[model samples]
Target: MVTLRIATFNLENFDEVPPNVRPSLAERVAVMRPQIERLQADVLCLQEVHGQERPGQPRALLALAELLAGTKQAAANVVTTSGPNGEVFDQRNLVLVTSLPVMARAQLLNTLVAAPMYQILTANPPAPQPMPILLERPILHVELDLQGVPLHVIVVHLKSKLPTNIPGQKVDDFTWRSADAVAEGAFISSMKRMSQAVEVRRLVDSILDQDPAGRIVVAGDFNATSDEVPLVAIRGDVEETGNGALAGRVLVPVENTIPEPARYSLFHHGKGQMLDHILVTRNMLAHYRGSEIHNEVLHDESGAFATDVKYPESDHAPVVATFEFA
Candidate 1:
């Protein structure tokens, strides 16, 4: 019986910014030490990582590892994957582990992201931007050998659709119009998000259509609610399609992770929303029978995240699960 633990976190602004007006690298590392250590996860997934340079997220993984240096087995390595924040020269994906012998020999399983599905977000604007054009958001896939059997894992972050109504924004008043601008492509920025989510589903379907027996875990900030459209569409469970299979839910049945009063990754209309998520294919879901979102983050004892006490953890918590290799 081989047990593999999987977890995903939106490490709130976890980056090595300027390094001037910030906590020492050492302090930052210490803050995360408890979380990573508590997880004792064999494989970890992270998003919202920032760095100064090529797919280099803010060395948060390194910092956290450093904080847990002596304890982490001597066989761990960092695998960096590029994300959408390349232009911001910030936030990237970092995969860390205590041990995975197959890692040294495991090849990228299914990363044939179509070229046409290019990213739509650009950190740098032609007239007023300084970042790169959106590429597809990074999703890390690796097939690990657990007790001689191979298991696949995928980590991802989907497009966000929060801060819904911005003034001066060319959003159509859906109630007033036959269809809102978002549905009709009113704001290129907002529409791009919907496009990204669709692309993810397309890619996932393409992958599973080829390997229905494959195990896949799709997790990250979706920015859409369990009752939202894009997600409903992914599962084809929306009233319109009446046919999707994907299921999304907060690990704990009670105690909402998306708290009120500016909870979630960002604030919109003075309300909090959950953009972070974890999704599993029907096959994989069966194996990963149970999971939870560790919303208890310690980003700060005060400030935008002061309300957290009973649950002190990342603003965007870590969603994790343990599974039996079937």
Candidate 2:
């Protein structure tokens, strides 16, 4: 059995820039390097990495990987792409850094459609500003050979509280028969994205459909709570989400790999919110022995090893899970 530590984190504002703050990439990398090294994840998925807006800025992700590899003695093999949208604020989707070599690589696997009513409406008291076009977030997939055996991995960062409604008025808020119409419309849009979530489910099932015993793992920074929406969506029932599915039925939450809320990857305004997760199949969990969402590396005050130097590294903590692979 081979134990592998895997993790995912928002790495909040990897390129956060204050209006007056000069773009200081090295300082940011300097703060995060140690925490990243301490996790020592065999597979690490990241969010919010920024790059050249006008082809002149430095590459933050690779440079950090270089710094980590150089300073902390980490040799992370890394792969990443810019955001799917042409104007994604120079922010990228996912940077999958791993020591384990990947078998297959794919990106932007799916997208959700908006409620039709939203498309037909015009902004009430129309804003002097241009409207926002609704966009579905991207999902990244990579396959790796874990100890000579194959494993499929999918990484996703879904949409935030972004409503699918047009500006000034909810589709129903401004139109005729708007009450139930608006509520139902918004719910339907939610269901659409949720359906997109199920698409990944079916995609996984399709893979296991051909190879019933195939080993697969889905890891990401899903914005929803495990029980609230995302995890339960794929887990088959509207109830609890699980670690595996086999023979066409969604399996129970075996191995209980993902921990409770206290084990979260992000904090906001002093409150802890766990938005990162790792869901594995029974085939993989059979070898799974350890799992924990690590925050010790944050280097924040009130935490074990607090330091202002490390405090500015990132707002989100890293969630890690360990399992033996064979």
Candidate 3:
């Protein structure tokens, strides 16, 4: 049996900014290099990666490839598909692989449903209200041949839960804006995230339709809790009806393999949260061995950010999963 280890990490806008910034390129690479080395994954799914402007331009991903040049996990190929537009803000998804060859690759952006600018409200005073909007992010899909086993990997950075106010409307525009209005904004964000999750589920269905026992792995920064609607939608939890005719075959969250207290991948406002996740299809789960969340690399001995860590590596940690295949 051959064992393959895979990991998902958000580099936090790597190689796109100028060196004059708080955390210079050198500073980020210094910490990121060791972290990647420690991960030692056969294939790595990276989010928030900076893409190349033109076909033949110098890419930030190449710089990252250089960082891993002499490492044991040196990638033979670094793959990143073009986003909807040519490299906007250098935000994109990237895949780095060592020995396994990427048989095929694609970017998924148009499959997700887009939310309209406004929705109709039925109330005492009906108004054309604004709903949470969905802005598509490029999802990196790559098919890799792991020891002759076809493995489909999808890398995603779903819509965040940040409150987005309507156009020409600020959060504090009016001192007395109703609490309902504020709550509406929050609901919109959640809706956007849920839409992305549904799209991912659709993608999974498409793959399974062709091959019932397809090997698939979905990994990324979900930006929502495991029990949240967004995650639940991706997991495809269908309540069992006595008939057992329409049961959904959903992906399993690999975090469950680890201990509860140590599963968190990020700390915000002093609260530890598991924002990063690695979920695999039922077919792939049969070979699943174990998983880990590498948070120690982001902090020092005293659980503080590493020295000269202006950026602190990333707000989130890397999650890795291992599987055995023949």
Kindly list the per-residue Cα lDDT of model 3 for residues 1-326, writing each as its tens digit.
88888898877766545556666666677778888888878878777766544467643465566557677667366677564454433555555554688898877664655555656232224555654355557567788887776788888888777654543334355542455555666667676677678778888888888877778889888998788877887877554223333243677899998998898888765667888999888777778999999986444223466434455487678899988877
lDDT tens per residue, model 1, 1-326: 66767666666555544556455555555666666666667767667665544354432344344544754532465545643442332455535343665443221212343233322222112124222224345555555656664445555565444323322333255332223423322343344455555555665666566666655555566667655665655544334444344332112211133344423443344445555555665565555646655544324333454553322335665656777764
Relative to the unseen true structure, what is the C-alpha lDDT of residue 144 in candidate 3, on a scale of 0 to 100?
A: 88
lDDT of 3 at 4: 86
> Which runs of model 2 end up more than 4 angstroms from their true locations?
16-23, 53-63, 71-74, 82-89, 109-122, 125-134, 162-165, 168-196, 237-261, 268-271, 296-311
Predict model 3's lDDT versus the native: 0.71
- Give per-residue lDDT, candidate 2, residue 146: 81
- Model 1 residue 253 CA deviation in Å: 12
Instruction: Report every candidate's CA lDDT.
Output: 0.50, 0.61, 0.71
| The candidate that achieves the highest lDDT relative to the unseen native structure | 3
**Clash count in backbone of candidate 1:** 20
lDDT of 2 by residue, 37-156 (tens): 777788887776665443665434544444465532366566665443533335645777788887887664343233223333444554465333344556677888887777777776
TM-score of each: 0.63, 0.72, 0.82
